[model samples]
Target: MPRRPFSPARNVKTREASQALPPLPLQDASAAIAQSKYFLPGEDLDGLRRRLARTLAAVEAQPQRWEEAFYHALHYAFPGGRIMANAGAESFKANVSTINCTVSRTLDDSMAGIMEAAREAALTLKAGCGIGYDFTTLRPQGAHVAGAGATTSGPLPFMDVFDAICRTVSSAGGRRGAQMGCLEISHPDIESFVTAKREAGRLRAFNLSVLVTDAFVQAVLDDTDWPLVFPAFRHEIGAVPTIWRRWPARDALHTVNERGETCCRVYRTLRARALWDLIMRSTYAYSDPGFILIDACNRMNPLWFSEDIRATNPCGEQPLPPHGACLLGSVNLAAFVRKPFTAQAHFDFEHYAKVVRVFARLLDNVCEISGLPLPEQRAEIARKRRHGMGYFGLGSSLTMLGHVYGDTPSLAFTTAVTQTLALENWRAALAIAREKGPAPALREDIELTPRHLAQNPALARDGHKAGERLPARLLHARYAPHLQAIATLDAALIDDLAQVGARYTHATSIAPTGTMAASVGNNASNGIEPSFAHSYVRNMIVPGEKAKRAVRMESYELLAYRALVDANVDAERLPRAFAAAGEIAPQAHIAVQAAAQAWIDSSISKTINVPSDIGFDAFKDLYLHAVAQGLKGCTTFRFNPEVHQGVLVREADLAATTYEFQLADGSRVQLPGDALVEYEGGRYSAANLYDALKEGFYGKL
Candidate 1:
């Protein structure tokens, strides 16, 4: 029999479903408030929501109207972490950017240029924004350095400076600065960069990724020799730090000289498959240096002509250009699912679409109101107006709807949801443009847009590029009827958009959410990710225990326990539909993320969890499969003895061993891990949020 397609009501008559979902218990609610710190015990949540709305809406011409709209949308509640933490809070509020991250262009290859870039990065980091940089601009090893009168040390050493700066400044400004570093696959020093994180405590503040190319993937598949090339002609015997090495890599027909150097200046060569294997092995074992499809990012970017997206913000979402900051928000999908787990289960479409459109306006207001750190970033904001509005609690939402995450029905449902939103997101941008004017960069000129450039292949190659006709993430999305009410308007707006453009450059993305939702928004699932476990231990740092004991944490799903009990369901049990991260297949995981990615204009931060016991060959196939699946980037995690921490822990694994630790009062207690460590009153990470929850020292339920 054919399964029923999801049909959300066009107009949600009541929030009876949301009211039915269990309210956060007192202890959990206390912990969540303690984590968010936006409201005090006696204060109503609406008070904080009102303050946030007033502050953000103040940017609009008519603040009061938008303020009410903002508060209404606040019911959906998935604003970015920075906004929740700082918005309208007198204690930490400022002209500071509420955006969580930015990627800075290291201006030049010289020491002065790098230092200048570092200074810029420091300023951005100090403003509570994480940063990213592509180290590809640095000269390869053995390059002459006239200033130092020595061969260049390569990009890795320079990255150490950024790393040190990050560590020093991470917690300096009441926020931890997250950093992401990227190097290209064809770079000569790529080997060193790949193995960088193998050392314990090395580059502790930075996440690394290799900017992979289509050529490299094809080369690996064909088992061809891939030459690592740099600008050989641009270098002199002792000249140091030259920005442009006026040399090009050899074409296929180019021949090698007698000395074995290609005329186009190949630095070194290796079998593509060998390099591919190393990356896979490192990812499988050490869990650093993920892959980013550089071409794919630029190819689909809304402002491709204006910038190059070489790196992403720390979380691998928001693939951005230099001087770009991440202004993000998410809609809580779990909140929208009605009659959860029953045959009558469905999403509240009217509410969802209304929330998306209203949130879109809210992000546009953020672009105006927040004081971004850099002049370049400010200019980017004024001209492009990028915002990463996305969704969280996808896994929980699917489970609530009785669909297993990574299953076909769930895939279709999410596709429909995202598709509906993608159109609405653009429509929102267009609606804003109608009043505020399209971003300065957006133009009707065929010469500038990717759509037009595609018509002329040669000019399209370098001059100007077009944005996606159909974003990769939504290539398969289909919306419900309420969205259809806007679909015609959406279509009209898009048709006008090709000529008039949008207020924002890029609109939709899937963020990591990073406990913003977990603690702040009633413990919603992480953005577009599944639950880590049915129940697991989370390390909660208590007072005066910066180095001692931990309070345990529990899953939000447990909130439904009381309701489950009333429904004659097992409160302690997880259903078959509750597909935790580690148990799901990697392919299934990627498939789910890819389905969401199709509609997203920016990127999605989702970790595909691979079982530690999986063989190397199967593990390696994961990355290849990600590429085939058309993912913008691929990040995978497996629990190895080397990196013992993980995001989700199986309940059985918690019972694997008894770990003993000293309490603050000098008393000792035995817990669930192989070893015990002091719990500081801050964020915990074995390396990832998923890992943190899965394998942290203690968990309270």
Candidate 2:
């Protein structure tokens, strides 16, 4: 018999479900807040408020000028339209922030605090925020249960429940709930977890990733065996008492270890490389199940002394434990790319460095001011003092300088920009340290090592005499225990500086800036992605109101059907725009990602948008090509929208519930209310008053 698909409405819909799932109580909100203050000095309220006020004023005063400047700078930094937009009313509010949460055991437990969790998710989404979850603690497929007749389903089924919730909630109308889901490597269901999304239509509501541990990675590298374990639980299997085992414990006196309450009957251990190969294969085929370097995540964790980081947020940018929220802000690299005095001129590093410093300070301020959803999130954030400061518009930046994204010159420029950005971030971080004290993990002796002194003979001697030596100051300075204690400075940071010389702890990440970029009118490539196309049709939703009641209306019905049903209107006149990667050649797309990857210290989130004509073999080759180019990860989208049906609803259809409107007064408004409005003649109209309120309340200006 085929098993029925699980529904949240059944079994867990009533208040009984809430009662069944109890919240994991903690000390208090203050403990979490204090932890955030200790680790994340960046979350300083006074500093953040001051910076935000200044930034808001600057943007409001000359919105267009700043938008154009950001657009131009980002274009110059990444000519491929990778960094879509930088600063503007719309850009500032959207894609620049996030809300992260940690589920206890599973969504069932998280559901105990469901109202709070949903409230948090809704609030953040309403403010144009993205969300992430760590679902590692959920039990595997079949196990004994304390409730539910002493039988178990598992995390996957529970995740389906969460997906339904996301679909139904509809954050703030214009905001679609974007989420990340993660599971740990040690979980008994790790393989199933990694391959969950491989079936194409499964888990479409969220992005999936595996939290890879050092043990798991080392086993893969060393070609060794791996173990699978389950958490302890009380059960009686057919009148035989049983206990779920944690791990094999060694007995000191007997020189033997007993496997306590072994649940190995339902588990199997495999060669780590074999599992790794499976992961790579799935990634190659589906462009999903990307890896999180668990060791790397913990090694540089500022709060490692207190808590363990199990997973990252949906986009895989910020790693957090349970109930931890990370606030993110990105600098428009293109904004800093100035044209030289000559028509054919050189890149400007000096000015770029200064802007990066300012941007870093601004991002730090966001943490202090942003409202957190959970006490756990607030507490975890404070303990680590973590922030995601990234860049956008690399493709545009390259184009501004007359450089093609894939060429050697372009790659070199990317490398230079990445290194310079790192240097500037570190310098600023150091200054902040002087003022606020070093991030808990930062070492005392970290200092800037001049570039010329290390590479040039003349500069080396001159620098040494002037007490500004390069190699010793720059290279040796990096090895300092204090700096190393914070975050590992690796190839991503070293590559740019090796040619020159610069140093910084944490640098490089590409964020998904879709809505933000569009608001600024720069086009949407979402960070380091190549433009998906020159133009594509987008669907919008409008609200309608009659008296006090409201209804949701589809824009297509307003424009397309109105012409057919009422006065015939031509749909051809509707505006369309292209995404960089959407229409570009496959090789060019690869080159574009590579060029941007050259400068970024961390992994980039880019999907090579391929046409339907490309074969599986070609897809296979693209993966190899990306790996050869030193890319950490890559995703590809075939033009055949049908392929995405089971995995994701078309963005156009989803957009029907959300939309942006350019008001007659030159202000932008976002509509996400429950009321419906149809688009006619490219304008929104509602049947009555309720619809007006729905549209009016959620519209962004």
Candidate 3:
């Protein structure tokens, strides 16, 4: 019987209009498919099917008890979104969504509508979605409160209330709710804002960052004083009129330090170089306290003509104004990698670009399809229609290219790749603009320019030259205008090559790639991390197992595979291989991240792998050097065998060790041996085989 080709109800265009664009040379389809087996989910239908089958098996094994477990598993698998077979799981995923809220307006302006907003947040959190808020609007401490009693409680007090709501509502079992809180440099309470998370265990549910403006940065660079002011507001309390308190002169010094309590310490002598140093120090010490460039963010803002942006989402991916939600997605770059050494081993850039374009549209739709927690959030989304499009498997892609990360060559390669990606993204965005109309905020006056226009007559003619007299016709076309069309890009993109600078508010972000990478069957160091060693054991908790059990290399037999791939060793049989930071030079790892960072508009989240033997001085030097190289930030983890826990042993250390295992035929197997292997340093190994033998034949004895 002939099979009917599967077709989607809507034929979304996945390619550019021009067929003249070159196609990726086709390699052996079978070989590509074979290699793709490891790639997983890169191809379309079959990959989705495989995912469904695995999910079903996991669910059917525990029918009633597996709902929560399955939800998280599926969420991790499809971070963007997914269609599920089980209505229950689908509902669960749908409920566990993302929401953005505005908190930058004065309490009277913001809170008047906040109770209802908080209620929305509470409901969303209760249902399992993460929330993000821009806290730059609340008046600084000592500022008068208008509505209630005309008294002052400040942003912190309000945040405390929000914290309580988040904690209470996001406590659903197996559902972890998260929050992102941000403040601006100009805020009167910048000192408290900078160190809000300094106390350990505080803000357990939230991530924090400071929104720095170009003016603030320039002030730091110029060693000039910066001001912290608050807008005056009127409110009635107990039938008495009250006015918001104003600081006569709030200097940068006051914002950083107050009366020697470490309230804030502003260094007037702080040069841009010095401030940059401080930021790097803080980031390296505590991963909190990231920077958000305000001027750049606003200059390119499409809504520059309308609204102002203050903070970003939790992961620092989207720089949204108050109540703005960004629909996010990433294309798996490794999926586009072709195999073999000939010209045929080329990447399918055109197809990948097409997919990205569709993904962009899908993300936009997500904004419309998703339910908002506040009216402000819904209103903002409709006004801006923002989305975050990024990439995953960057490290894997670099490895496949045979480029050692952290090296000069790798850095150069990364720059080229980023440029290519930026250009493609621009083309896609432009096409979308033509189809759906440019975002309401997009400036009609912006123009495209070339990098070396000054030296090139042709470019000059196209309005790309610097200091060149423009002809009447070119002037009329309004070509070669400022790139600061999008608010977010104005702060991030340093070099302006394409006139498409502010094409979209924010075009890049790096997320924690752990779960998504895992579902794709890749070692999970998504955008900015090195593979954390090839074979580290994962500790798992099983019923009746007094202690957590460890599972080592369960799939692909990594150790064996590594040995097989080693050119120096025997090719016929696999050997035992353990990959450490040293296996692939540390420099190479750094280079790979640097490469990816080149293309990213925002910073990358990466931890450099250092060998234990490296001295503390060396570590400090490494970090300092990274900062000098213009890298946004760097974290390092040195391997210490002294801290290593030996292999697994016994479950008796934990007390009890008995459990039941389900069989394929709707049956159960009872196990009565140690289920956990205990080792020093709080590590454990699974004694499943031993337990299964005692339990009976149905177990994997």
Candidate 4:
């Protein structure tokens, strides 16, 4: 009888049977990303999901409200990269932050002040947060520093110090740190700042931007002389010729007016068009130093009564004041499509709203656990309770619904989805405030000023006088331009909000979402961008490693179409509805962004892709058009292979380009960028390997 086969008791809870089996192997690309980027020791894919959902929900003021069903929503609503990676893992570590974006306290002009700012930035970066700084406050080169009795080296050299600091922190922390360096358009060092990235290996850790003012735009359009100015030095204040201009910093050397302009001494003057051309040419070639409409940002700011925004986060999505902080999350729009690629296809907005509402609460909870490094940073969050709840996968979702990106139908669809998301976010904010007291800033009494009246003329039309005192809730809901637009959709909701303030100062900002979209979103198109290509190679930086590895990637739309419609799909030959970033017209991209911007309070991070062959006239015209279209800011990308390796590379571009590699033995080898080479048991694309070595990050990894 073969020893009776050692049969176990029937229905018995045996240890082997009772114990949970290891989670099923990762189901798809998204799982693979989660395992590598997010998972901790002894954690599998499901373990990560459970851990994230459990940990985040436990911090909620009303945990029981979302403890059960919130887990399901996590599948569709993705927290930002920092939030997902750090929210639940605090138990295993110290000095980590859940917030994704922060801005340093206004940098002082003294050397001690500069070093203090750098120290705060280091602590912030070490905690896995991206920070921004306004450098225009510093005196320009050749300016007298009374304390040191020497001419300053100017803001550009200080920026280099910050860049190096970012690099060092990124290397030691095992998480790449990001920084944004902003200089006002009127700064004497603007020219140098505009072309800073042209030099290889300079400012490697920063995303540079010029804070373009409305006055500067007017001067450029008029082709008139533009003054380069800085705050008058204390000793020479009366001797210097001064002009009144809007400035971010204030001190005894400067005096503010009812209109918010400060007195500054002119250092130099140049033809505005010449400066504009320089900006356009440098950006066209280097793909950076994006321009932020500083005037527009301040005018549209919800906290205009209290804050003056001079800089934005690395990607230019969140324009922030000194010491400001914000957490970020996104709802996966592609996950809401029903009956994709069919005549009856439609977005399941009902379910989408549910996820957005839950996500808003989860983000609100993050404020409680925000482990910001500095006391001011933490205080900023506690006061304003600002968070950016955005969405990703607009491009992939549009394709899935049979709409072409940047087309008429696509613009309409984008508008509808964004409007719905914005409204729901506000509603969630209001509901949360009703449960939990409103943000501290909202409860305070704020004074109305001439700037407020100028920003919102409707207030004067309504007989509201400047210098009047009003509750911040009323100022935000009834006076803020963004909320006034929200009132058009739901007057009662806005009224309720006025009676009881919202949970956060800002509700929506679309980030680039590069890594988040690629990994957790299963290669979804980035925020507000069409697919780079149906199939491409992405050079991704590995945390804790020096080198970047090129990974082959496919668009989410292509994967869905292949799985749902055609099993044998050729990526190169797709339907008319399929369009990549390179194929779309510049106007179309701006139109799509404008449609979304109408509802978004915070800025949108979008790059209007232009062909390298596009003429300078056409390239320059895009910025003017963006300004005319009422966009808060605009950024464009044109490939320049000589400048730097792109984050995303199309196979066709790679195959067409050639790379020459110089070995340590003084021998050289030439290969197409797409060619693969195996070395030390590891494989890498020729272009990526060359770039890694040239950039001095290859040998270690």
lDDT (Cα, 0-100) at 202 in candidate 1? 68
Query: Across residues 195-310, which tens digit of lDDT does each residue of candidate 1 receive?
Result: 98886656767889999988898999999998776554433313422222212133233344433343335677899999988998899898887989987887667555445577
- The list of candidate 1 runs beyond 4 A from truth reads 1-44, 90-95, 235-264, 443-490, 540-551, 564-572, 647-651, 654-701
**How would you encode candidate 4's per-residue C-alpha lDDT over 1-701 as one tens digit per residue?**
01111112321222222121121223255565666667787786456567767877797666766766667888787888887788789677678998889998898988999999999998999999999999989989998877677899999999989988888888777677899999989999999999988887788789989999999999989999999999875666678888988777787766666676887899999999999999999999998788999989988888877788989988889999999999888888888887666655688888898888888888888898898989999999999999887888999888777777888999999999999888999999999999988889999998777877877788889888877988999989987788889999999999999999988989999999987888777888888889888888888765544456777788887887666556576887676667788888999999999999999998999999898799999999999999998899999988777777888887787888889977779999899988988765668888887777666666543
Worst 10 residues of 1 by lDDT: 472-481
Cα-based lDDT for every prediction = 0.69, 0.46, 0.44, 0.83
Per-residue lDDT value at 273 in model 4: 96
By TM-score, rank the candidates, best first: 4, 1, 3, 2
Across 1-701, the per-residue lDDT of candidate 3 in tens digits comes to 12122121111123112212122222232123223222232434244434433443342334334333333233222324222211124433454333322232222324655565567667756644456666655666765544566655567666667777776664443333567676666566666665655554356567666666656656754767565545432222323322232222232322322221113222122244444455444444444556655555544343443345565555555556555666555555655555411122335666565555444543444444445555666666665566556666554444433443455654675665554555455455565555555454443332323322421244556445444443322221122222222223333332332223223544555555443443443443354544444434433333333343454422111222232223232222211112223344555555665566555554455556655455554545564455334444445544321122112222232123344556669898654433343323333333433332332211111
Question: lDDT (0-100) at residue 253 of candidate 1?
Answer: 38
TM-score, per-candidate, Cα-based: 0.83, 0.57, 0.58, 0.93
Clashes of 3: 27
- Report the number of clashing residue pairs per model: 23, 76, 27, 0
Count: clashes, candidate 2: 76
Error of 2 at 333 (Å): 2.9
State how far residue 54 of model 3 sits from its true place (Å): 18
- lDDT order, best first, reads 4, 1, 2, 3
